[model samples]
Target: MLNIPLIGLKADQFRHPLDLEATNTLKQLPGLDLMVRQLLGQLGEQFFMLENLASSVQVGENQLPHLHQLLVEACKTLDLEVPQLYVRQHPMPNAYTFAMRGKQPFVVMHTSLIDLLTDEEVKAVIGHELGHLKCEHGVYLTLANLIVLAAGQISPLGTVLAQGLQAQMLEWLRCAEFTCDRAALLATQDPRVVASVLMKLAGGSPTLAPKLNVDAFLAQARAYDDLSSSELGQMLKQAQTAQLSHPVPVLRAREIDRWASSKDYESLLARSGSVCYDGETKTKGGWRNW
Candidate 1:
């Protein structure tokens, strides 16, 4: 894996504009931020951490060594603090992150997900999760998780607040995923790797993964983008994703394709410094001037 070190990586460098707008909207809510942290942050983090410790396999140099190397290399490329990684047994292929202040943050990947993706693709998944921590999406992400989990028990007054905030938070979360997809692209330094991961997630199983064609899947994404040209089609598109936690897979593929060809992506890559990976030193020193 090529380590393209972004010496002073900041969230804004890769943050999706929609994510910025939605985050600003959430911040505008009076007392919402403080209320979320004080009310749910502490207990929610503890619950997730304990659950993972009991149910997941933690990765380290001595365990899943190759996967551990990917995580270390990606963190170095993005200039992020390496968080704990855990692989949990599950049939579904997926990954997620839970982070909080004053506590150890961690990323969890399903066993099936690792089974499906290659080493570079796995690194992209790891980078995508790290983007959440880099962007501080956890506070709101936890709140959204809480709302979904407790929606049935929330009081009428709490329901009113949740109803209003849920829509906004869901939208923000979807946008946040876009930013993380970009992070995946940066980590892998290959747009095709990011798009391939999304494509596989859309429908590829262990049986069909080897037969799937990435070029054909990308063409399908273009067709999907074309479908939104009409007004009714646009509405249909919005309706299809209205309640989704992440944007539909084709939309994500399309976004990465566009960004990969954009000047912004080109400039960022041009400005980055490359680190050669050897057995003795995991990464060589390099820094971005601006």
Candidate 2:
């Protein structure tokens, strides 16, 4: 759980008040922590507590050694020590990280995610997952996944309670995602790269990606803005993303595109220094900074 060194490490440490407010709101809620503690074991076992790490045909040292190299390079660039990474067989393009404070951390990437993305886009995904680790989002996201899976098991009125709480969580998840996207930007030090990843995720197919246009995708994002501005647009948006886990891909693409060019993103990179993965740095000196 890295503290992100918001103040001194980067000039772009503009903590979104919404992000802070959400964190505070979560803390004030009674029993959620206790509930998570009771439930985490059941959930963590699905991935974190497995008997053996997934066998990979390749990793940083072998197989797609190129990707492994990229992962190591990204970690080095971000001043983060390399964590173990795994690729799993799955159709959906995705990645996730799991770790608790003082625990071993690791990341998983779906084969499909890699299949559809370019090497640079893949780095953005790696950086995005690293964003979770940097922001200490693993524990919460881990528990949230469990809660969603167990949503229907709460006995009577379980569905209602689950739906209500899930909506609250979805809101927080969206904003937290934004914070992590910034982390990815910080790692890559290139908004266009990050934005291009978003663009591919939005409309890229295996066959369509060779010709995918970053500018056209951005234009689509701007078009989305225009579309969402009208009266029908508001209703459409409310209907579209009301149930989504991640923010809409175009919206995320648009956001990264905008933030990439902002003074905030650049300032963070300028202030951030080169990191050596082989060396050690004090993690945090304060309380549960998350």
Candidate 3:
């Protein structure tokens, strides 16, 4: 693929508007930031780092070189430093990232997720996780993860407070996902690739993924939009998603389809230079080696 490196990309240049709004609202809540960072930050970071190092296979030049190449290319394209990448043994097809101040950021891809996606789709997934880092979503994201873990163990009085915080965190998380989808698109330079990843996640297994159609899935996304056109449908939609951390797969695919053709996406790429490289080896182009 002829990929472009967004030489001086900024998160705001492509960040979804809803993400910005939700993040600002999070920022306005007094002491939430300080409390999350000062209280839970270091412990959470250390714990996750140790857990990954112990249980996950870290990707690098000598190990899982292809995956490492994907990570390096995506980071170069997004103008961000490469973080550690780990493949963990799990049945769930999911990928997530962790970043916090004074800690080495990292991304984890479930083993099942690797089996479910094509190489390009895998790259898009990496890009999506990197989006959280690009936008500096570490603190709130760590808090959200920790909150879920701690919610079940809290005292009765603290449960109410935890629930309230969890609700807001989930709302922000869903909005944040849209922005990450955009990042995936930016990294892949193909909306179809990003949409395909969503489609597979929605209803696909290793066997089913090969048979799924991106066009049909996009049609289904449009249907979903129409389904929510009525007031009751809108309410039901809200209720269904209120407690969820990520946006619905179809909704994310729809957002990517819309944003990929937008002027903002085009303008961002227009200002950048393309690199001539296939998925494997890099070739010469109008890009600099970072």
Model 1 stretches with alpha carbons more than 4 Å out: 29-35, 143-164, 273-290
Who is ahead in TM-score, 1 or 2?
1
Candidate 1 colliding pairs, count: 0
Specify the highest-lDDT model's number: 3
| lDDT of candidates 1 onward, in order | 0.83, 0.68, 0.85
Q: Rank the candidate models, highest lDDT first.
A: 3, 1, 2
Please give the range of 10 consecutive residues that has the lowest summed lDDT in model 3: 281-290
For every candidate in turn, the CA RMSD to the true structure comes to 5.8, 6.0, 6.2
In TM-score terms, candidate 3 sits at: 0.85
Q: After superposition, how far is residue 251 of candidate 1 from its true place, in Å?
A: 0.7
Cα lDDT, model 3, residue 92: 92
Give me candidate 2's TM-score against the actual structure.
Answer: 0.77
Q: Candidate 2 residues 156-253, lDDT tens each?
A: 88898788778877877887777777767765666777777777677777887778887888899899999999999989997888777788878887
What TM-score does each of the candidates earn?
A: 0.86, 0.77, 0.85
Best by TM-score: 1
- lDDT of model number 3: 0.85
In the range 1-290, model 1's lDDT, one tens digit per residue, is: 77667766667778899998876665676775777877777887889889988999999999999889999888888878788999999999999997766367889999999888889999999999988878878876765666555763677777777676677777888999999999998889898999889999999888887778889999999999888979999999888898889999988999999999998888777766543345332333543212
